[model samples]
Structures are given as C-alpha cells and as structure tokens.
Target: MSEAARQAWPTVRSIPVSAVTDAKPPGRLRPARLEQVAGSSGTGRDTTGGGTATGVGTAGAKPSAGSASSAGSASSGTHARANPAAELGFSGDPGQHGDAGDGMLHAQRAWDATLATNRLDNLGVNAERQRLVIKDVTAAVGLLVDGWPADVRACVQSVIDHTDVSVLALDLGNLDGAGDVLDDLAARYPDRVAVWRVAERPHWRGGTATWGESRAKLLRLDESDVHVLMETSIVLRGDGLTPLVAAVAEGAVAAGWRGVDPADGREAGPGRVPALTGDLMAVRRSAALSALPEDANYGRNADLELSLGLRGELVVPQGALPVERLGTHDVQADYRERESQRNYDGVLRMLSAS
Candidate 1:
C-alpha cells in the first residue's frame, strides 16, 4: 500500500455486538416499523435472516394489536402529509407525469374511499339509522259548497279512516248544505275533527270567503308537526298521509301528491316545476305559517308561489299516494280557466322580474 493510502485508513477497533443488538427504536413502535418498511419494500423476507438489523433486534417478536393499529395510523398520516406519489413508489416529481399521475392519484383515492366504506359496513355502522317519527299531523280542508255534500262527506270520511291526523274545516257559507255536513262530521268524530263555520261564501262562487284568508286561518288553527292543505275534492284511496309526513320529516319544507317543476326557466308547468301543487300539499307547520300569503284570492298558483318561497326542498311522491279526486271535474270551464290564468300570470311576472 502507498504511504498516503495507509495513513488515510484508520486502525480497526472491535466493538461488542451486544451494543448494536441491545439498541431500541424511539417511542412505543419498538423495531416493528423497520420490519414494516422492509415488508412494504419487498425486502422483509430477506431481512428475516439472523444477520440483519431487524432480525437481530426483534427476532421472533410480533406486534400487538394496539401497536399494529398505531403504526398503521402513523403510516397513513405520513402518507397524507407527504407526497402521495412518492409513498406509492413513483420516482421524481409526480407533476411531471401530468394526466397519468392524476389518474393514478384519483384511482388510489377512490380505492381508499371504497375500503373505508366497506369497513364501516362490516362494523354495522349504518344498521342503526335513527328512525323519524313525526306525530300529530293536522289536515285542513275548506268547504265552499261548489261540490255536493256527499263529496264533502266522502273526503272527510276518507281522512278519518285512512289516517289518524286531526281534521279542521272552514265552512264558507255552507253552500249546497256542505257546511251542515262538515258540522255533522265534526260532531260524529268530535275528538278527531274540528269545524269553523262562516257566513261568507267562496270568492269563486260569488260569496266572501276568499281562498288565501281562509287558508291562513286554517294555518293559525293547526297545532301539529305538519299541516296538510287538503282540498274538499281530494279523497284518499289508501294511507297517503304517511308518505307526505315522512318526506317532511326527511327535510323537505313541503311534500305533495302532485308537483310541478319550473318549465324552461319559467314558473310554469309542462316543464320542470319549482312548486308542488296544492291539491294535497303537506307542509311543515312552522314553515308554511311563515310563508303564508294571506291576500291571495284564488288558490290556483298561490301554492306554487308558496313552495318557491320555502327554504327547503319540495317533494311530491305521486306514486306513493293512492289518491282520487272527487270534485272540480264538473266545475264551469270558463271560471276555472280565468282563475288559472290569473294565477299563472302572477307566477310568470314573478319569474320574469327575478
């Protein structure tokens, strides 16, 4: 050897093997982390030899459940805080690969999300969903005598038979003996039905009980979780009230049997409707009370306006309701057309301005 090369090499001193083998890894992880890193890198089997650091330090030692969980959590945290691509074995800058790198990253994230969801399912996390029980729904119907007394009786009777909700009726001038029928219903089902009779008649029939004012009065009288705006013409063929109530409890401001979505950006039908029809509208009592429009003379498009003004979703479960109509089919065509046009005009104007 050259004199300079000999001078550069230091004299060898023997160190005890116990000094290296006895050393412990920092924190509670012990030396299992080294084995984990080696396992992920595909070199753990080779490192299992007695001469390797892991084998010497942690021979025949297995990680406990708690330590394994903690180590897995720590590894996940590291992966999140550091470049994910590097953790996944990608070399150099991940941004340089552009689309390919983005695709892989997305795939990885998707897999992680799926795994988490599956884990939650296995643990029965979703098996205990909280049940929604909305009690004491109030059904309100306005009587104008435009339909027959039998129709009114059938409508009220269906409500009492199909559901246990309380019934409240406003008898407007008792046209065609409809008021007397409502009084009889209230007397027959005294505990479940309440009636308020008025001398003023409906505006459509040429009396004084306007649609908006009468509906607002019904709203004021309701003392329940949900208030049903039912028409004297709508008769339930099955338990239609439960679905509407469930929808309200599920977060909708109002739920109805018939609904329309706004059509071509206009507050009109034959297109998407932003409003539910008032035929058998069920609304959260407080929300309906807050948005009630008292001056509306005809109930036509007034319901649509109220729905659009609500703060929550409008849901109409049409198929869920086994409902049949009993009145308005025999009404004068000209009067219905005029009232509908008036309401649609208001809706159009509101849409145009907004």
Candidate 2:
C-alpha cells in the first residue's frame, strides 16, 4: 500500500479490543474468542490502508468520529454484547412494557389469595356481631345553653322529669342568670343534670356558644351514646329526648325537630331533612362527633356542614315531641345574623365543591 493510502486508512490506536468485539453482529461472533481478546494484553496499535485489515474483519467498523469515543468506552468486552433485555427474557410484546402486565397479574393473584383466606361466611358473622352490638347501645343527651336563666332552668327541669338518659348542660358566659340557674339545677337534679360553665360569650346567633368549639369541648368532656344539642331557647313540652334518642337508636345517625325553615318558611321533615335544626337535635355520639370539622368556627353554619359531611347517614324527626320556640333574645341579634350568613356561605361553598 502507498504511504499516502496507509495514512488515509483509519488506525485502531487507543480503541479498546472490547469495543471491536461489541460491534460484532449477534450470534455471528464467538463469545469465547471475545473473552480471550479482552483478557489479552495485546495493546499494540494497528495501522492499515485500503479496504480492511487482516484478522480484523468488517465486524469492528468504526462509527462516525463524533460517537466513536462513547461507543469505544461502552464496548469493553464480550459482556458488552450481551443484551440486557434478552437476559431478563422480556416479552417483546409492546403491551408488556416495564412488567406492567405482570404487576397487574400479581395484584390480582394477591386479591384472590386474600379472598381465599377469609370466607364470605366469616364476613357475615362479623356483620351480624356488629348489628347486635348496635342493638345494645343506648343514647344520651347534652344540653348547650347560655342565656335566659329561667328558660334554661325550666328546660333542664323538664328534661329531668321526662327523660331517662343523663343530661349535660354547658353554660356559655352565663346568661339569664344562667350560672345560678345551672347551679340550682345541678344541685336539684344532681344525677340527671351535670353543669359545665364556659367564660366566653357566644359568637353565633342565639345565646348558645359557638357550635364548633362548644360541641368539640362537650364531646371531650362527656361520654354519651347520643349527644343531644338542645338550644335553651326551645322549651320541650313532652318527652322530647326519648323519641329523639329512640330515632337514633333505630340506626339513625341523627334526630331533631321537624320544623319550617325560619328563613324561607319551607316545611322540613325528618329522615332526610335539608338540615337538622341545631335548636334541638339528637346525634349518635360517634357519628356526630366524627362529622365535626377540625377547625370550624362558631360563626358559620356548622350544623349544615355536619349534615353535609354525614350525608348518607340516617336523620329523623321526633314527630311526637313538641318543642315550643320561646324566641331568641336581642343581645347580639344583628351580629348573629351576619355570622349566620357567613356560616351559610361556607355551607354553600362546601356543597358546591361536593
């Protein structure tokens, strides 16, 4: 070959033999010979001209100059030619990308295993036990009040005279001389009436404390099967709590007064009412307690929020129980109306989101 021709021909200097071996076609190259070449110390640079060199067939054809360096580094030994996908025995079915089908199959198999481990009959037994447990449960009441000491006293006295369940009266800021009234009621009916005093004034309408914090506080202090949220403004003429508690006892999550909405004068019924009048409502302790929002304020329509959260849960009205509305006091009427609107807005927001 002419010197010029030899110079023009590509030189395999600095290119690893491994690179040469990896560039070989699959199945055409011998793995044993490739391994041997890799282990060999033959580091001499080869210079050639014309078509190709002896012993170095077209297998080690050099790629473009740009990719040659990277290709050379990657193709170090016979192992370089080994297909990672082939070693994994990957099914080339495009559907089997990243073992996704296998993952789904494994998930199905796990579900089947779980189903096999626990028979349907076992589940039935558990459900029956749960129903029996609920049958044995009895409901209790919690009265939330703040003002009109005579009204609170009268209301509590009626509850003592009529209902068999325990009543917890939470006095908020002590209105209508409620502090003294609560004290007298507590002293008179020590077993039935348990009194708690809150120093803060009610932020919501009516003389009652804020529903959110007040309800939460009451739940924390008292352990009752049913929690009756009774407003001191409403006077009970009959065994109001008994029927309410009975409604809750019949798998109902909540029970309250069936009345016309004060704002619209629309008749609201029991079972699935638009909202439970907070003035008088009996809630299953677990259900109502669970429905309360963590950071809910007293100003917004908290009762509506609670109802919305427990949408599918049962709600009934104690039809036989007559609750006489003695009307709300004027002390914070305007602020209460504004706060109620704020709460109603919150309820609308929640409902829209749902």
Candidate 3:
C-alpha cells in the first residue's frame, strides 16, 4: 500500500492470542483492514488482528453476539454492574469517591422541607371564618343585710384577689347595709364587680327546696366557661380558680372543695367521698345549664343531685384549698335534714326504676 493509503487505514497492534476451535488455511497470513476484524467495533474484543480463527479476549470486554438470549443477558449484566445511586441521577460526594453522602443530604433536606410545609399548612387560618372571643364571667351574690356585710365583703375580696374571674352581687333586701357594702365594693372594683338589687328577699332556708330559684337566677345572668356557685359565707384563701379550671380540663363536669371529703386532712388521698358544696363549686357552663333539672327546688341537695345525675362523669375537689366558713344562718341549720331527705328520695327513685 502507498503511504497515503497506509495512513487512511486503521492501525493494528499485537494482542495475546489463546486457543481457537476453528481451523485455518495453510498459507502465509495476509494483512486485513481494521474495520473487517470481528469484535473491533469499540467493544475491545478484537485486540488481536486475526479473525475468529485466533482466539483472543480483552479484559473487561463485553460478550460478543452468540444467540439472542445470550446477547440480552450480556446487556443486562452490564446494567446490573452500574452504580445504583448513579442510575438514579445521584452524584456521590465530591471529596469521597463511591460514597452516597451527597444523595443522603439531598434526601434529608427534601424530607425536612416537606415537614415544614405540612406544619405551615396546619397553622394556616381561614379568612372567611370568625374567631371566638371568650366573654368575661358574670356573678351574682344573694345576700340579706343580717350584719354579714363584712363576711360578704371578705368572700367578694377573696374572689377578686385570687381570680381573674369577675363577681356580681345581687342584694336581696339586706337591712343591715349588706347591699350598701356590696355596692361600695362594686364601685371600688367597678371592672370586676357589679351590684344588683332584687325586689324581695330570696327564699333560701339552708334546704335543697330553693335550688330551682337560685339556679334560675344564676342561669339568667352568667354564661361563661364556668359558673361559680360561691356562698357569701365562704372566703377563699389561695389561687382556687386555677385548680378548679384544671380539674375541668381533666374532664370534670364540676369541681369544688368541702364538697369532696379528703381522707386524713390531706388534699387528696384514698377513701375520698364525692359531693358538691355550694360554698365554691365551679360548674362547667354547658353541663350546669343543660343537666341540672329546672323543677328541682331543694337548695341543700341540689349539688348532690347534680353530681349524681352526672355520674360516670368527672367531679374533682380542690384539695386542701383554704376557705373560711362564715355564719350560715338559715341554710346551715337545716343542712343535715335536707341532705338526708334528698339522698333518700334520689336513691329510692333510682331503685324503683331499676
């Protein structure tokens, strides 16, 4: 071949030869063009210049075509040898060869971003919906002068001092200036206190018979988160409202003290009795307004009846919650008799039905 023709032809280099099953013609070997060599199409298998007669194989060379299934198997084998992360478009760490740290960091960031988006979605407010604003609680104290204005004042003061819950005093013809004292306190703490005057004295005789009237009056005025049935004779000593509210949060229908008999002078322990004292019972507004019977007039047994009706429901006491007992003139005297009758009547009625 001429120099230009030689330059145009592909070059051939010596490669190791192995065994061949085919026979070759007995003649001197002739030079063949590189393109005519089988397995020379960049597959690296035709390292030797000789044809199939000379058995030669390159390192890491792909399998040459034999049968359809064998060719397919060879292609699949090459694919299986590929790096998994690389097949998924993930380039590993620049500093660490064959390490998937970069891919992990990317996946972690994606997960964090998804969580943040979910949190923001949960916090998003609806523009068309109205928000609820809790109204301040209204309170009414039924009092007759009876020279107990100081006691009433103390009760009112304790409520004001210990709780953000407001109080209102409803005076029922207290001739001994109880109304005036309550009025003065209302004036002093105008934001927290209010005074109302009833035309006649309320008929409360320390018995459960007057529950209907008292509950009616309370229901007429206060519709807050809770209604405090505070007796004017009882004075609170500490943060009574907090524990009461906390009890309510624990699924209590009502909560109070002196209502629950604490064992061994402790706040709470074994052998506790469940009862509701009108002294300072916090009744959940919904439960009180809904469950309490309208015709039930027994004042002393009202708490017990209400609690009984709410059986299977929660009723907690503010254990060891200090509260001073002032003079319980009409109501305190007949408490035992009224309570006994109320309980007996309730039990008998329940048994008859059962």
Candidate 4:
C-alpha cells in the first residue's frame, strides 16, 4: 500500500480474540460515539450510506409526523463526520487520481465509480459530526406465508417494487406450495429476500405452530430497529412502509396503516387507538421483544393483544398511504370464531386489569 493509502485508514480499536474458537464474523470496529462535552444534550444519531431512518431526531431535526429525517446529511448546525484522508496529503477530489504503483488495482473506465468511491483522498473532515456516535438503522417487512401462494407472491413482489426494506418471511408447512414460491423469490432476489421454513403448521390449519410463536420468531430473527408486521393479504401501490417505520422512530411503540375500537370493533381514524390492526403494523423491535405475545394461537385478536401489551403509544399516521388489502385469509370459519373468542377473552382480561 502507498503512504497516502496507509494514512487514509484511521486507527480503529478492535476486540481481542481469546484462545477459544468463536463463530463471530470479522468486523471493522467503529466507535458508537465520540466523547461528549459537558451539558451537551444526550441524543443518538445512527447513519450509514444514505436514506432517512427512524429514531434519529436531534435538537434541530424537525421530523414531520410519521416520517424521519434523512441520514446522509446532518440535521442542522452540526458538521459532517471526520475524515482521516483529509488529514493526510491527498486532496478529496474525484477527478484527480494518482498512480497505483504496486498494490493498487487499475480501473477501466473514465468515471471509475468504484475506485472513486473507495479512494481515500475523497474523504473530508467534519468537526461536530464526530461528537455523536452514529449507528446504522435497518428495517424489514415481516410476512407470514401460509396457504395463500398467490397472495404471498404478490405481497413480496409489491414490497420489493415499492419499498427499500428487505422481506423477512416465514413459511409454515409449505402450505399450498407457498413456501416454494417464497424460495423462488429468495433465489431471484437473494439480497432483498429471506425465508425461514417450518414443518409445523399454523394451529388454525390443524398443525402446531401458533400465531404468537411464529410472530415472535420473526421478531427475534430480525435485527432491525423497526419490524413491520404486514400480512400477505396487503399489497402496496407505492412506498407505504417508510412512514410507519418513521412513526416508530418518532417514539411510538407501534404504528399501523389503520386501527379499530376494541369495544365495538369499529374502524378507528388516524391517531392513538386502543388496539392496532395487524394488516400493516410497524413496531420497535425492542418493544416487540418485550411485549409480543408468544403463546397466542391465532392472529385474529392476538394483534390487539400485542398492541395492548406495548409500553408506549400506539398510533396510525394521519396521511393515507398507498396500501390495500385484497381480502381476508381463508381460515376455517369454526377455527376463526373459536380462536378469536379465545384471544378476545385475553384482551378483556388485560383491559380489566389496566
């Protein structure tokens, strides 16, 4: 490596490996934050390549309701993060490229986008940007693939077309060959699709897997700050998922496309509601981990159960988004009635206790 190349990299701290073998992947150790000055407001900012994220509200960041501030740039008054390359002799210009010498690889094109982005001289220092430890925030659409092969395919494809988030799907017993469809989707879009298959069928389908169990499993497997509990019945005409994620980032425990009254089961307007509909719901992963009901068998009323259990406010965004529900899932009428009554019983108990 050249002198400029060596100086471009910062001295990052790393964890020491012990004698025992561990399966953790190799990582580039980055600090969560730099030291804070006295009396500074303790707020966190998570950033990465680009795009707006949830839960990044700083003092000057006036995020509109159901939306978060963009992450590529600073909110206000704050400078961009520090760049080690700036301290070295290299000037941060894309047009100027030095000789590769021995170690550097040569580029083929005039633009040389890959080399330009990787070049260290392009880095610039930001004074205040280093003060806050920037963490990267991620989100995923959680889908339960049951017997509806057509709906499952449509749901996954619509999300891929409309939103930037990846799809996290759980296929139960490969019902109706839906699991096979999910597998094909994953193969086609490996970077955006992930599926977990299970032989245990949903309890409504006369197998053992319960709604609470599978829902909790999805939440556990996902590492994103936001987990969207979207059903396969819903399809997106546009980017409908981001606002719900932004709502969660703004501090709501759960945000959904719509809500309903638990008392009379009427559709509620946009705002805080007693319970949120599961058709299109977004929740903070931390809150869901602590609150999601893992024992409920059916999702019919169990969504309300999860909604009531959450620690913070449950809300619906004021502006309408481009999402639609084709129809309800085709569960057995008897099973639906029985499981809903059972879960509603739990909801009543919770309401009474509170």
Highest TM-score against the true fold, candidate: 4
Which predicted model would earn the best lDDT? 4
Report lDDT (Cα) of residue 28, candidate 1: 16
Error of 1 at 117 (Å): 17
Query: Between which residue pairs do clashes occur in model 1?
Result: 201-209, 260-273, 261-272, 261-273, 262-272, 262-273, 262-274
Q: Give a tens-digit lDDT track for model 2, residues 190-210.
A: 787776665565655343345
* TM-scores, one per candidate: 0.58, 0.56, 0.50, 0.63
Task: Give candidate 2 regions above 4 Å deviation.
Answer: 1-136, 204-209, 259-265, 293-300
User: Each candidate's lDDT (Cα)?
Assistant: 0.57, 0.52, 0.47, 0.65
lDDT of 4 by residue, 252-335 (tens): 667788888887789874555668988899877766776777888899889988888886667665546799898888788998
Order of candidates by TM-score, top first? 4, 1, 2, 3
lDDT of 4: 0.65
Cα miss at 304, model 1 (Å)?
A: 1.4
Per-residue error for 118 in candidate 2, Å, reads 44
What TM-score should be assigned to candidate 3?
A: 0.50
Give the lDDT ranking, best first.
4, 1, 2, 3
Runs off by more than 4 Å, candidate 1: 1-132, 135-147, 262-273, 329-332
Q: Could you give candidate 3's per-residue lDDT for residues 1-354 as a string of tens digits?
A: 233321211101111113331132212211212222222111112335343311111222333364222443455575664544443334555553433455544544444554454344335321001011112222233322223778888988988887667784555554366767777787789888755554344444321223444464554455355567777778778655555544443344555664443122223211113455556666555556555655554555555556545433334331245667887645444655765476547634543553
* lDDT of candidate 1 over 1-354, digit per residue (tens): 233321211101111112221132112111211111121000122234223222112322344343422444456764554554444445557455434555444555544554555455345342221112344333344333343788889988998898777787767666688867876787689888776656566777775556777776676665556778888788999777776665565445676777675444333221113677887877766677667666676788877777776666565542235799975745456866787677777777766766
Q: After superposition, how far is residue 32 of candidate 3 from its true place, in Å?
A: 96
Deviation in Å, model 3, residue 198 alpha carbon: 0.8
Cα error of candidate 2 at position 200, Å:
2.5
